[model samples]
Target: MTQSLAKRVEQIAPFQVMAVMARAKQLQAQGEDVIHLEVGEPDFVAPKAVNDAGQAAIANAQTGYTAATGLPELRQAISDFYQTRYQVDVAPERIIVTPGASGALILLSSLMADVGSEVLMPDPCYPCNRNFLTQVGAQARMLDCSANPDFAIDLDTLAQQWQAHTTGLWLASPANPTGSVLSKEYVAKAWQIVQQQGGHLLVDEIYQGLVFEGEDFTALSVSEDIFVVNSFSKYFAMTGWRLGWIVVPEWAVEGATKLAQNLFISAPSIAQYAALKAFDQDVLAECEARRQTLASRRATLIAGIERLGLPVAASPQGAFYIYVDVSSLTDDAMQWSLDLLEQEFVALTPGADFGQRDAHKYVRFAYTCDDARIEEALQRIERFIAA
Candidate 1:
């Protein structure tokens, strides 16, 4: 007899792009040329200092698990990073290192939300957020958000959605898929509303250093009551290393640490040691140079898409993706993406992976590859559209 799976497992929706990526990989193995813009990870290698540190840790036999809250020095470094980078002061004790931003989200959702409670988010958000809420038996409430005014959640929308069962709000800066960075004033105002309602606000700033066009600010600059999660993945080019940390309000520190101990024990020990060098001047300078490259690629894709007469729903200020309006081309972006991959050998993520609000009319293009490849993708897309 087959074992029955948990009901919650069934409620989770698949990340649609993984299937597209798998098919693209299969085609690549068969000697077909495929351009991959479906994934959201960077194509850069880890900083030299970071990789060296990892090797040194291994040479020194430092593979043991760390403290549940992480190394004290690492936590202090993260706290100091907030001070120097964002000009905000955060106590080291309030920081808890996790396996990744995903781990931090799981910890927050588990602690902050309970069965029958609701977590408010904006539509066309990072889809895993909803799945995270679902895993905790909480509802993911998506409010209709527009790309105009930069995909922000206004005070009025928050007020209208406020309900007896609403537990908190989950947000992102330099948000995934859309790459819209919410402004400091806007985030402060939203924090005030959440405070008035006696609820928590969690902000994911994983793409903090990747900002290009506007001022970059962390939620800590607004108020310390809000929860902030960041990772070494995006800015440090350490995705495979799987290390991230969370900034919790002082009251939640004990509980968060206890949960970390039980759920993850600690983040990767080698990765933790390696990330200590992430703040080195040389490493940071290299990362900044890569940021410029990403900005140029963003410009290339946006201009090319516009030249092809395809509408862009919003302009991405940070991160590496452009959420495009493909309604003129096809009502079903999923099918269109599949057909594009099969016919054009170009892998683009359909907006269906993000959310359900007119998702079929939009697709997310990640300029994770080099500028030359991004230009080539534009040329191929133009030919595909014309054909």
Candidate 2:
């Protein structure tokens, strides 16, 4: 009955994690104590202040649509956040509040991609990045960056991969799965190389605040020309709120705004008001506390994986995930993930969901849960491996 669906929709791959998540749900319904480690969502909720602000917005009837770009006050709040936190002065007009980082990426792809044009990105990147580019009929050329220990993009490698129809390169700092972050020096140089090639550079820094290991710098600091995608989902614990923002260069703000006006009209008014409180000092302190908890969980998971002799694909510097090479144990990570859930009651994400770089050999474990859950998941892994 749905054979008439568009070819692009058919080309979109199913998110294998959701399948695993569904199975985990079924197990839970059956009264099984399934420990979930597959999902990337933080277990923390938004700060109490943020919650109160959202409720207050609804009570005050502050639910009208904002400008296509965003509420000027929220944009200015983000600007102030940047200036105070990063020492980077981003003008309010350049900031575009989005429905979520997903929306932000769509706006970017719509503006930048065209048929026959390609965008370069690292393999094992956020899977949705490829899908977003695909929806626009643009080529999502995922380069194999698994060989890079830190998971940072190589400027020289990027230069070699630039094609005649290449429109830009998309990258992430403190990226998903491996949680690898790029240094400020690397980003500055990468920007130079891409600029020289006459192509744009899009940076996904959705996991900005959780960076515990390396230098934390925004692509915005590198230059105003960089298009940055950020979200409240990870660090701010606002996934369900569906809020995010994009920092576009001054020259492209109008184009971005027009797309936003048509595609989304505006981000949720209530969420926008709530996110304004996310920059509050007390709220930020709570987010920091959550980050520290995640850091502890990360240590526990990494040590357990090491003890099990599983090879880490990359040293995770931030974010909640750790990419592991499981080829020694199984050739199909998806099947292995399913089996682990069914037998050990521990769920994880397979690499196939992320990319084609030895996709069957890798899986990602997210330590976004509590330390106790992390410990329990590791024990299950140990037992499962021993058996």
Candidate 3:
């Protein structure tokens, strides 16, 4: 007989993106044409400078482990990035390089949560944030966001959830799935509340560079108590690189460093070396081009979905996801998504994977594919809806 999994492991839900991608791959392998729009990975290639840096690092035998906090140059680069992008004075020593933004979440949860402590996050947000909280033995409190409000966190609801036992708050601006961006004013207000309640704030900025409109703000720029987590995945087109960093408050730096050493050993040495070149002008230009492409895809997708009579609750200003309400088509988003996969050969993520509030009526589409593929998928979806 197979041994039962640990209770902690059993409590976590399966990652929905992986499940959808696997099904899409299986269909493709069987010679079935499938348009995948479920996974939030960029279709762009890594910048040539990044590739060259990786090759150079390997040639120079930079394969051995560095400090758990990451290479000094990479850390300094990260600091400079924060300084340049957000006008925040971040010291290099405050940065901790990790496997990915996911890794940083794990580390943050472990560092912040005591058993039975509560961590509040927005509903229909990144599902992994909730799962990571559970794994750390923290109560994951979901605050349902309004579609009319562009799925942004409501300050009133957040204040209600701000209790003495609330040890942390997890926020994802230009959030996953919904692609909602929090305003600077709102972020500042929320940070003040969390600080007043004696809790830490963790901002997941993995999609920091993917904004299409308005200015992107880092939480650190607003408050020093905030722990900013970012990755090279989305904007840098380095998902497989599995490299990211966290900027902690000055006092928490030593504790976070120790946790990084104990938990991750160090981020992949080769990825760190490669990411050193991620800030070069040539690479920046390439990433900017990709951003423009995503902006175009977003416009195309919104128009297509509207034509199909599907309701997009809000216009996403950042990230490449369009969270749509498909209640008119079907109430069961999972079944609707599966039926679309089988009938229309298009893969999407059910909103249930993000949260339970009216989730059955919603579906999320990722516009990470090329323009041609996106157009094809839109046509297929239109046909499927007509049927």
**Where in model 1 is the C-alpha error above 4 Å?**
146-148
RMSD of each: 1.1, 1.2, 1.5
lDDT of 1 by residue, 133-211 (tens): 8998998988777544556676766876889999999899898888888888888889989998999999999999899
Worst 10-residue stretch by lDDT in candidate 3? 145-154
Residue 126's lDDT in candidate 1: 88
Q: After aligning candidate 2 to the native by TM-score, how far in Å is the CA of 156 from where it should be?
A: 1.8
Evaluate model 3: give its lDDT.
0.86
Best by lDDT: 2
Order the candidates by lDDT, highest first.
2, 1, 3
lDDT of each: 0.89, 0.90, 0.86
Off by over 4 Å in 2: 1-3
How many angstroms is residue 178 displaced in model 2 relative to the true structure, after the best TM-score fit? 0.8
Query: Which tens-of-lDDT digit does each residue in 1-387 have in candidate 3?
Result: 988878999889886656666778889999999988988886777788898888998999999998999999999998998888779899999899999998999999889998899888877788888888888788788877754387777776677777878887888888887887878888899888887788888889888988987668888889887999999988899888899899999999999999999998999999999999998878888998999999999988888888888888666889999999998988788888888898878999888888867888888989988888988998998888878
Clashing pairs in 1: none
In terms of lDDT, model 2 sits at 0.90
